[model samples]
Target: MRSSLRPLLVSIVILAAASVGASSARAAASGRPLGNATRATYPSVVSIELLGRSMLYSVNFDQALNENMSAGFGLGSSSMNIHNTDLDANKSATFLPAYFDYYFLNAAGSPYVTAGVTLILNHSSVKGTDTSTGNLEIPSSPVMPTVGGGYEYRSDTGFLFRVAGYLVAGRSLTPWLGFSFGYAF
Candidate 1:
């Protein structure tokens, strides 16, 4: 049983790494069809939230490789200066999220739905009590996966306006409610 399990574990790790490598390559190759393609769509989005003492803002951009696929990256950060009991104890955090999207319908200037997974890395700092009545800072790091869906409005010139909401599951550091605005190019 041990021998069989060893090979299976190795195979699983190799497959996972290969899958990530393949998607990275695809995102790079997606730009290849630019000149001959009918139009390349791109979207840029900005979002803001108000939840008690905590506030957050995020921005992301998407480039449409073809009619059915897209990839995007976003940066976000939040701060809690009020320090309420209900608020998460972390003073601040920053996250970088990347995702690849597949559009169900094929067409320009039409509404389409997308499905994708997001890889997020988070860095946080928490305040703690110090002996001298001063505050001490504790740092934390974590990574998580988020899945979501949204709608896109394509255009003839390859620029688009999109609105999407996704629930991020895993650590509750970031709120489950999130939105994206991007374009397909």
Candidate 2:
């Protein structure tokens, strides 16, 4: 992590945490996306994805602000350590993905487009030995911006699934695919 980006990252994390915490503390809080009073009765969703914007996997949540709009967020993290006769190193990363979607139809199944920013929180350091020491970082920026569209099937019975393709500005501008499964209520 770069020193200059720390404060910005911390501020964002703190503000988001506070906002989410406060919303969830409300009398009727039920994982719904905080929005105007009119949207309070809409259902919210919780899901887990494989190979999505989080890079590997993420636990995701979505709050339906209305029939055609949704607000979403996700959290993902990973750590790796390697040690051998000559090299030892460790790396860790955490990701927070915030996004929004617009469903084309107000039905049980719909096609949607999404746009969001993913905060990449990471650190990698190698223990220095008499022989060598090293430090590494990828996708140098502290954030990744993404846009994509896909089909989502959300049933009245609380079942939800989505298969999405995304263009993510990470490491380089690349295309990524994600599949998700969860429940809405």
Candidate 3:
């Protein structure tokens, strides 16, 4: 009876080991850990960006159409300071940019492309030292079309980092670059 029980226990242990090896092999072939794919999906992110000439704070909502593609929209605004010491003048610009983004996902990080428009409202003033008049104020509003692209990295723990650049077409071609950090939920 003892000999028979020993053989049965050894058979059970061998079967368990084989099942574990097979499952691990399947996971290895897929190139993803057993439970990681499901944890990687986040539908929305909110971020604050420090741009080349401004500061933008925005919220974005994204939907993953597949494993490699995502579509999203973002809205943000910035109040930028434009200063020229030679002219003794200071200017401020307020911009509202609304855009759509497309993301390409990979094993390393995700890269994205964007297209958008910005409503720019600007105001400027000359200092009294530069002119006889105490102060002179000028204001203007322009609608500009823009396109941009960027890369984003999101860690498994929900921390995110992004770097992006934008080209705005107005009276002159203006380039804006930004870096942002945020959380994904």
Candidate 4:
């Protein structure tokens, strides 16, 4: 019984090797390379951004899934003073943005459109000369939906630049413009 099993095993192995060789030969004849073909891997980029209104600042990290799609997250803050009063206000927001880019024109520089949602946390305080109210502090938290588009330029040497505009929905729709510069690794 052991001798018979050995012959059967050798026959199975020989058949398997012949099949693999035949597949390789077929692929070669068809002009198609087989096994471990080269593929493009997109790099991740990190950046810091400054918003034009309300003095907002943010840090963002994005990664390319393919040539035309990327996704990222951002954290930002802003502060301002109210006119005709001694009141001050401050706000901070976090965003999850998804981008769809058109890379048809140029690979180094591409224009993209983005849509995102943000979780916004706002705090306000009033100070000075208010005997009746003294010092007052207010805190509010809300979720804001947003949409925007931008143009970005990235070089092979790691230099990066971007500009974008966003409309955030709240009690009213607020527009935000941002500029960013960073290095890509």
Candidate 5:
């Protein structure tokens, strides 16, 4: 009975979120065409995010395939420090991320789920103070898989705002929370 209820609860939650995007009520009150509130008009979105799927920050571009689906890619960079017992170092890395987003509606505001992978290219600009412990192990490249969900607000005039939480999947799961500001032109 408990297991059976899980799916039912999830369905209810999804339906509730989708219902928030319904514009018929707003249309009736404001006297505008409901057709205007859709992804059909604006199919492309460009955004800049902090601590997003890139695991740091990114400038992203996405094209909507339909009302519910989108695909995109991003470029980002990070300056990190590794301070520990064995090694102390600071490095700059570049990240390339690719992802897809599934929106619950085509309205001005909607809920969305996203999945992506990021390729990290580690640059050889390591700065450290403790070299007596023989600091040597360095990773050339690494790829991480990520998934998350969030809400997006897009206006008819092309303004957009988004917030999301992401999980990096691997031997250890790392969680990241991010937000973005962009346009949907």
Candidate 6:
């Protein structure tokens, strides 16, 4: 089982790296579109959000596929071990999202909508003495669909801010809110 899992994990890492490299290469090979760049400086951003009781951090890298269309990769974890919980279990999960975004209202500083799939890895540990479940750790993978919309604000100092909200549909359907601030190249 260990040998089989090793290959699967390696493949997943390689595939993710390849996808990012491909997108970057495409973006670089193509020349900037006419007046399409706008004030949006960075194609990628990292956002940290507090989902009510849970905490999440994500890094989103985006590439403009065309004038009105863009795609991005969101990678992050929702559950982090900050302390020991006597009553509750310690849980953690990471999400990889491949999303398509549309800049429908392309005004000076307009809003947009994004929809895509989130491939998630969930892990949990009930290592406390609260329940019969002993030092426990489990991992699983699942894919979910999400949709979100937000406004983009461009700053004079070559920085951009994007705020968005997305929902994942599944057994533990989670809702996440994100705000990313970054500079363009």
The number of the candidate with the highest TM-score is 5
Instruction: Give per-residue CA lDDT, model 5, range 1-185, as digits (tens).
Output: 54533653565445444434542343356554443545666689887776676554688999989889999998976544463343224455566789999999878788999998876655345323211111212233366688999998876555567889887653346677777766666
Clashing pairs in 2: none
- What TM-score goes with each of the models? 0.49, 0.64, 0.54, 0.57, 0.68, 0.56
Model 1 TM-score on a 0 to 1 scale: 0.49
Alpha carbon deviation, residue 132, candidate 2 (Å): 24
Off by over 4 Å in 2: 1-42, 78-89, 123-137
C-alpha lDDT values of all predictions: 0.41, 0.64, 0.49, 0.50, 0.65, 0.51
lDDT of 4 by residue, 1-185 (tens): 44523653564455445544554454456443332221122257776665521225567787776677777776665433343344543422233333333333336577777766555443223221111111111113345566777787764444456777776554456666766665555
Q: Measured by TM-score, how close is model 4 to the native structure?
A: 0.57
- Candidate 3 vs candidate 6, TM-score winner: 6
Stretches of model 6 off by over 4 angstroms after superposition? 1-55, 80-88, 122-141, 172-175
Higher lDDT: candidate 3 or 5? 5
- Residue pairs clashing in model 1 are 40-185, 41-158, 41-184, 41-185, 42-183, 42-184, 43-182, 43-183, 64-184, 64-185
User: How well is each residue in 11-52 modelled by candidate 3, as lDDT tens digits?
Assistant: 445544554455445555655333242214544555555452
RMSD versus native structure for model 5: 11.4
lDDT of 2 at 129: 14
Q: Judged by lDDT, which candidate is best?
A: 5
Best of the two (5, 6) by TM-score:
5
Candidate 6: give the clashing pairs: 41-184, 42-184
lDDT of 2 by residue, 1-185 (tens): 74643664565455445534443445254544333222224378887766677765689988988778999999975333353233323454577899999989766677899999988755223221111111112355677788999988764344567889998775557677777766666
Q: Per-residue alpha-carbon lDDT of model 1 for 1-185, expressed as tens digits? A: 43523653564455445544554555565654533322233433222211101123455655556667666666655543323233344345454566676777665444344433333233334333110101111122244455555565544333334445554433342333332222234
